[model samples]
Target: MIKKFTLFLLLVLPISAFAQRFSQYFSSTMVESFENPAQGIFKPDTTKMMAFNFFVPNLSASAYTTGNATTTLKQYLFLHNSTFPNIYVGRNNFNTLSTNNNIYVGMFKMFADLAGKQEIGFSWQIRAEGTAHFTDETVQLFDGGTNFNNLQPYTNLFNDRYYAQGYHQFSFTYRETLSPKFSVGYKISALSGIAYDNTTINQSDIIFNKNQSDGTSALYLNLIGQHRTSYTPGSFAANNVVPNFKNPGLSVSFGVEQHNEDGVHIQYNIKDLGFIHWGSDPHIYNFNHTDTIGLSSGNAGQNVYNGASFITQQGGENKSFTTVTNGLAEISATKYFWLDGEKQFKYNPILVASKQLFYNGIAGAFINNVQYGKVTVGVMGTYDDLKQFNLGGKIMFKSANAEVFLGTEQLLTSYDMFRAHRGNLNYINSNANFTGAGIFFGFALKFGADVESPANASSIPMGEDEGFLKRTFKNIFGKKPKDYINSPGATSP
Candidate 1:
């Protein structure tokens, strides 16, 4: 179980993708704009008519492990140590592991109308989200059955759960203004699932009885579990990661912005609410203990493993399934301040709370940024529902025509992880409650005719001809733009 779990966890880390780029969330970069749908990418007087990444991927990825498995996982995963990780059995204790990344393979956005407030965008990206939980007893059973000889029985110790999904996202995003202060945006996406793996053991119990006459141990295991995956064990293929319609899905994101007159910015979003259907014949297993072996052989542990295999075989099924995407809802506000009375020296503090739908994940972050002209540095403190606390920082260079940034959300813990990977054995004893790392970087450019505000435009006189979105869906949303959306609304788009 330990070996198998390790393999699965490793696979999920590299291939899986999902990200909440906090620093970039308000940066107004092409990636951030598409993510929010209601966020604008073009400013009439400053930015170009179009924005794109030219296939240069703007990406962020992160993974973390918690509970008693932290130390041993670091040693084995980073240092290639052969030592089995320590585990605390008998209690309903478990360890957790998660990995996420969001990669924009390519994106192109344009001003659909003369009014800078109306814009349309298209993008191709990859996204994923996942988490897993495993009990110490499960790890112990696979770690040479360290204490199985004892005359004790255990129940529910082997219960565990894992679920992860990854897919390609092709999106069409639209944003428009209501009355200059309030704007709305939405993104509709077609999704192609790349991978899906889910399994849960809701109940399990084990008892070992030894026959002193021949030292033959009788074993009994009662388990109930359901497992589902895109492919069978040893059948995972490279083509699975490539984009395809075999597993199709859809999602949509809606956003609203309130532009405050006092140099304050606020935005609300309902992002990625949708589902996917796995059309291919996925592998499924339903274990219920009826297939358990009669008795243990000379090697008691060997029989346990064999019994598990038998149940897996008896319960295996090939079928299709449906699953929901990891949707999100968030609201954020930022107050901007200019220091030194130069406007070039600026300070802004932001508060954001993000919650996940159909998943047990949420976070609240407080960010402080200081900027000097085109360069800005930010500090962030965040806490998540998983009880993890993090500190991170980022640096960005943004201008009217181009933007670039780099940062991490798990700075302190990532340092320990870095040390472990650097062959610093001392990291094994670090006092960090968890182990994780995150990194993100982005680059984008804008081109074409400079978007001109009404006062500076040479085009026809501006009138009450509303934007395309507002005209097309007038009844759907009848509101004025009292607020604007985009990262650094206090700065240029």
Candidate 2:
């Protein structure tokens, strides 16, 4: 009777389900300068610049029974086969089904401008993330006999669980203007405070004793695990407890910006160039457990054991789990050109084009890392001489972003390619035909500063000294500066 009920649940339960993927959001204010670096390239009159941002993402997953009848039945039978008595084995046919959510908040500000040439900045960010999984299974059998003698076969099982994890980060950065045209900056980030929480409940039906009248039976089991690690709030020390590989990493970036007299701009930066260790040792969890037994008319139920154990077996057996230490790098270039000159009309339109390339590993993950390219085009225009608006689209040529990945899968079977190990798990190797496309929309507002700086400092007297200062600095710095004052025969003093 217990087996029959388990089968029924597997067949009748809703088969439509999906899996979630990682999603990231940057604070609108934190990203304000990302869109147009020119807007924030110079120190504002105010020494302090503060911004706040929030990000939220929703992910989900689901799987349904597949394969030949025998294969499916064999997989079904394995669930009832138990290697250890009292071991819990809830619904098993459904491969993957669950939803995960992640939220991130970041705050940043420029605290001080040293000697009006060097600026110091600081930022603090945190993330709250969690995942929940659900599954159900049931079996049914029928025996022939008179109404009073008839036997009702029963089988039912259900399990649900949730896992939660979080972390926090604090970073400091210093920017120094080596010359009027060239500058260098460095950032040191320290992260700490990691926590985890997990819970699970398993239910099944079984008969304790037979001989008397049939009686309904049920079993309930619950398991929970929680851990918290302490670390220095603003520094990484030997005693610090790292969170996950993805969460515990330090990064440094060196960037150069150059602007031509024609308003063309270019920038390059290498980020996540370092490694971080989350835990002193790897943690492994084994998920292979089963229960199997059959009831017959003339003998005790037959026992079937699969020798599969659930949860990682401790002692003598070691698993290697490490996070990526080498980080990726990015290079970007942009050009701005006038679309409409309104010296006569009072309003002007400008168009900007940018291209970016990202390689998973900078030092070298060449064969193992993934790389992609992207292009963006935008138009900026002033309306009524008081307001401005900008619109643009970015085309990517590589693996699809998380959003595109989940959306495309939603239109197909409930099974998630990554969860089922159906194909290459890496984004680069995933079924390319199915994953590759994302579109983003954005705009900006301007309130002050309208006088455009003369492209060539030749029009102003001090322009020559400024231009010479920038050129001489660039030569010494090995990188050109953006917006050099226009001047002929200008030489550094």
TM-score of each prediction? 0.88, 0.37
Q: How would you encode candidate 1's per-residue C-alpha lDDT over 1-493 as one tens digit per residue?
A: 3333464585564422233456766667787898777778788788889999989999888888778767666655665443544566677678887788788999999987765378999999988877788776765564445456666767778888877888999999988876555778899999999888777888887776655476554656777888787777667788788888999999999998777777677889999999999877578888786433334433433556666656554478788889899888889888778898657898888888888887777888888989899999999988888887889888999999999898888888778778877888788655444878888888999999988777788786556667766565544544422222232454422
lDDT of each: 0.76, 0.30
Tell me the lDDT of model 1 at 300. 39
lDDT of 2 by residue, 1-493 (tens): 3233224223222121111110101111223222111123233442223332222221222222321121222223334321221112332432222222212234233423323244344555443233333332211111111111222332333344444343454556555554444444555656543533333434333332234344422212112222222221224343333333333556454554454456544444543344344453334433333333333342111111111112112121223332222232433344433334632211112222211122111111000111122222222211111111111122212111111211221222223333323332332222222211112222212223322233522243232323333456668865444333335555532
Query: Clashes per prediction?
Result: 19, 39
Which regions in candidate 1 have their CA more than 4 angstroms from the true location?
Answer: 1-4, 11-19, 82-86, 207-222, 290-310, 461-464, 472-493
User: How far out, in Å, is residue 213 in model 1?
Assistant: 10
Predicted candidate 1, C-alpha RMSD:
5.1
Whole-model lDDT, candidate 2? 0.30
Q: Provide the RMSD of all predictions against the true structure, rounded to 1 decimal.
A: 5.1, 16.1
**How well does candidate 1 match the true structure in TM-score terms?**
0.88
In model 2, what is the error at residue 327, expressed in angstroms? 2.0
